[model samples]
Target: MTDQGLGKDDKTPRTARGERTRRALLAAAAQEFGEKGFHEGSISGITRRAGCALGSFYTYFDTKDDIFRALVADMSGQVRDYVSPRIAEARDGIDAERIGLLSFLEFARSHKELYRIIDESEFVDAAAYRAHYENTAARVATRLAKAAERGEVRPDVEEVHAWAIMGMNVFLGLRYGIWDDSRPADEIAAIANALIEKGIGTRPD
Candidate 1:
């Protein structure tokens, strides 16, 4: 996995240090939760795995649930940031969907642990997980609506189409990023993009 976390490379010393510590804690928490589930995962175990003092954990997060929420927010932001620029760059192109797919697949590859935690959270708390998922889907739908207004996608297509496409990417990430790592990222993304474009993109006369 790529070291994309804000660690030694950040600008502000304090911010950088805090981000490093937070990343460490999240990494440890992901492992603990993966092995034992949320209820069984202990703060002491997470602190120990993170190699940080118990007191330090409280400085950043109040409770395990808080950390879990942070993890979800962070992962969602990462995915949005990954795809936003690519979508913006596409501007008026037919390949915006492809670019978005590749960006998402790349983010999943770099942040597999975070992705796993997000996926696992669904099974742990179905209602809360669905709420979070819907929020993310809504954001994607808004972006797609804007793109459609700009003539990047078919104008007749509804925002639900974008929600469905985002769901497809999430499931694709689960399969390629977590279940199997054999397939190339580009290939997987291309296949996904092809399906979406053919299904919803505007066709020229």
Candidate 2:
């Protein structure tokens, strides 16, 4: 994960050491919640995992709920940070989607706890749960719009198309990334890219 602050609500660390401490706490929180879940997880577990004093946790977060909320946002940002640049290297809109899913599958395989933590947020923090997917779909919509402007995709692409593609990627990650790892990331991405190419790609013939 990036060495960045969790979110606006999180007490932004001032010093480099403080930033490191904050990142450690967030990483620890991911593990704590990822394995034991929100209810079973404790601040002590997080502090212990982080190898920091109890006071260090509170220096950045006020309560368990505060930290959990921050952690959700942090994880969401982590996905965006990991995937965006790779997508930028794509040859065009369709290839961008392929790269996006490929990177996401790779990220999910490594961060195996990501799906569990995000899934639990629906009950633990509904607002953050909604924001995660909504923001993701918005990014897809924006990408599709840009692609249409570039004549890479159908001119009629809209919000619903974005949601459909986002939904497909989410499930594909769950099945191929979390449930199994035998399949190559590019193989899965290629299959999905085919659908996008047929559904939306602009035709020259």
Candidate 3:
């Protein structure tokens, strides 16, 4: 539920209806931005997609740039929320990673716009782009550290290791999730999991 980097303020909705309106705007913005890059996407297109008025758009976001930033944060939270519980259900630390990737592939397949929007954020909003990946890597590092404490992985597991794994997942998701999804998600996860296990799992001397 991390807000990425957005802060709550007076603009934040207090009513359920207001929240729904804001969410609709964000979802519509995702479609508009996803189909058309930031520069091409327009605020009017977002309102049209959301079935709301121009005034309604301003009700939640001050401008297109504002919503785009919010979208990045929202999507980051969405990914974490979708994958974390599934990972928590894993039998062990290594299994958690396998589940994590499997869930992410499924998410990417369904939300194909995810990659395009996130990638575009690198140029459109560098701060949000960096925050998204940094937050993701931090989560991975935390999980790895916990796994190590549980004797499930090498005790020396560190941030660099987490970044490495995150890097692999990002591309793996692009290949198996966005570009094409003919292959089974679990199959991809298992393959990647094996690599992670061999490299980091505890072993006997």
Clashes of each: 0, 0, 0
lDDT of 2 at 175: 98
Position 140, candidate 2: lDDT:
95
Number of the top-ranking candidate, with lDDT as the measure? 2
Candidate 3 local Cα displacement, residue 94, angstroms: 0.6
Pairs with steric clashes in candidate 3: none
C-alpha lDDT of all candidate models, in order: 0.73, 0.93, 0.92
lDDT of 1 by residue, 1-205 (tens): 1133433233222677887998898778877876777778889999999999998787677678766766666666777777887778874534666677777777777766756577667866565577767877786677677777888777876767868877887788778876786889889877776776665557784
Model 2, 1-205: lDDT tens digits are 1135455544779899999999999999999999999999999999999999998887888789888999999999999999999999999999999999999999999999999999999999999999999999999999999999999999999999999999999999999999998999999999999988985556875
Q: RMSD of each candidate?
A: 7.5, 5.1, 4.8
lDDT, model 2, position 20? 97
TM-score of 2: 0.92
lDDT comparing candidate 1 with the true structure: 0.73
Clashing pairs in 2: none
* Cα error of candidate 3 at position 39, Å: 0.4
Clashes, model 2? 0
Q: Using alpha carbons, what is the TM-score of model 3?
A: 0.93
